[model samples]
Target: MMKLFHSPTSPYVRKVMACVLLRGLQGKVELVPTSPMQNPGDLQAANPLGKIPCLVTEDGTAIYDSPVICEYLDGLGNAAPLFPAPGPARIASLTLQALADGIADAAVARQQGRAQQEEAGPTPRQAAFQERQLAAIRRGLAALEASPPAALAEIGAVAAACALGYLDLRLPELGWRATHPKLAAWLASVEASPALSRTLPPTA
Candidate 1:
């Protein structure tokens, strides 16, 4: 079985795990919990960047980053491909995935900002940085709401679900649902999937 380095609360890792379950390849892969912040040697050996969701193939080829890992898993089973083949649909899915991933990135930045404020009292600079991330998230959410995905069966939808899930998990104060009802509704439907439900980030 392939091995995956991941953290229970990582949205990126959640995306990959969701993909694995969606593809019916759960039994083919093993999850190894890891934290990049701690820089574990095993993670480093698998991925120099020490990132979670790194998949080590049977041939020992290590694939880092969620996009790559998810694609690798999508190919493992005869189930419908989460990532559409190269074409207009593929372009659309990849674009949506990028936007969703951007939201996740901004959310993480906001979380780090909170930590910085807690460690060393809130500062004008930290506030400014957070405002910027919030703005980015707002823009991303608006984009998704304007043109919702045709269906939540592609990589893009998977990514968007995890991104919104992370926001709900780590930054509820943002109140994204109030501003983007359409996106929220779509996310709610996607979250109903058994595969996605199984990969929900651990609380506390």
Candidate 2:
């Protein structure tokens, strides 16, 4: 069996799990509850960065981060490739994935900045850091609204949905739906899909 360093709150972990579910390999992967902040020995052994969503194959080969893990899973089953073949289409999809992941990155950055702000009592540096992340997130969301992914079929679409879901989980105060209606509508239209519905964060 394969082992996955797992955390329900992690968007990165959710991406891998979404891929696993989409590929119908749920039973093959064993979920190991892990907290990267705690720097667990077993997780570190598999992923030096101690990141959740690290996959240790049955043969002890470890694959890391969300994008790489998603790509790896794309190679597993014949349920149609989430990743496209080499060409302009693949490049476009990867670019969208990068943008979506950047949105997720900004959300995580704001969380870290919030923690630091809470600890240090709201310094100028903390405020600036959070503001930058928020700006980036807004820009990315705006870009998506201008042209959303077709559906939750490809890796880019999956990643975009995951990133949006993560933002909803961590930053409900954003209330992005009112502003970015198209992206919100797009998400609502496919949020019930098997891959997304199954891998949604534990939030209700």
Candidate 3:
């Protein structure tokens, strides 16, 4: 069985879990709850960057990052490809996934900054860091609203939805849905997928 090193709270891990469900490969993959912050070395041994959602194959090869894992899982099942096979559709899906990943990354950074302030004393630098991260996230959401991907049944769509859901979970003060109604509606449609519905994150 493939061992997945993941944290329940990680949007990236949730994205891969959603892919596994979508591809009907849940039985073949074993979920291993891991905390990168508490067990950094263990995750680092699997992925040098110490990221969550690392997939250690039965053969012992480790795949880091959600996109690569999603692609590999998609190939394992008889279902339609999570990524388009060729041309513009493929490019658009990949681009949307990248945008979504960017938003998630920004949110993570902002959360980290907040953690730093709470752990120690609030510093001017920390506030600036959070502001910059939140700005990037808002910009990415706006861009996604402007050019939404047409293929709503692919891994890219799943990734984007997971990112938005994470934002709702972690940064409700941002008011993303109020500003981007179209993106919010698109996310609602995507959330209806059985794969996504099964992997919805628990409220924090």
Candidate 4:
């Protein structure tokens, strides 16, 4: 069986877990809970970047970052590919994934900044940086609303769902749903997937 370094609240890990479910390979992959903030030695060795969602193959080969791991899993079975094959569809899906991932990154930055601010009130410059992150997230949400993915079964849709999920978990004050009704509706539909529901981040 393959081993997956995971975090209960990491949207990236949730993305990979969704792929595992989509491919119907849940039994083949073992989820080992982990955290990058704690800097676990094993996770660091498996992925030099010390990131969660790293997959260690049965033969001890380690694969990293959610996108790479998802593609690797896609090759393991005959299930429909979440990532489209080389062409325009592939380009569009990958681009959507990148944009969604960027949104998640911005959310993370803002949350971390907020935490720092709580610990030691942020300087004006730091507060401005955090606001910038929030602005980027809003812009990304608008772009997604303008051109939502056609299918929830694709990588692009999966990524967009994960990004919105992260925002809901960490930045509910953003009130994204009120501004991007299309994107919110799209996400509500995507959440109907068993893969997504089963991997939702733990509230605690």
Clashing pairs in 1: none
lDDT of model 2 at position 25: 92
- Model 4 poorest 10 in a row by lDDT: 148-157
RMSD of model 2, in Å?
Answer: 1.0
User: Residue 63 in candidate 1 has what lDDT?
Assistant: 95
Per-residue alpha-carbon lDDT of candidate 4 for residues 145-196, written as tens digits (9 for 90 to 100): 9998777778888888888899989988888999898888888877878988
In model 3, residue pairs whose N, Cα or C atoms come closer than 3 Å (at least 3 residues apart or on different chains), thus clashing, are none
The lDDT, on a scale of 0 to 1, for candidate 3 is: 0.85
Candidate 3 lDDT score at position 15: 91
Q: Give the TM-score of candidate 1.
A: 0.96
Tens digits of per-residue lDDT for model 3, 1-204? 999997777899989988888788889998888888786676788899888899999999999788998888877979788888989978988888998998999999988888889999888888888889988998999998996644457877888888988898899888888889888778776777777777777885
Q: Report every candidate's CA lDDT.
A: 0.88, 0.90, 0.85, 0.90
- Point out where model 3 deviates above 4 Å: none
- Better TM-score candidate (2, 3): 2
lDDT of 1 by residue, 115-151 (tens): 9999999899999999999999989988999987656
lDDT of 2 by residue, 66-119 (tens): 899999999997788989999998998999999999999999989988988888
Q: How many backbone clashes does every candidate have? A: 0, 0, 0, 0
> What lDDT score goes with residue 32 in model 2?
94
Candidate 4 colliding pairs? none
Regions of candidate 1 where Cα sits further than 4 Å from its true position: none
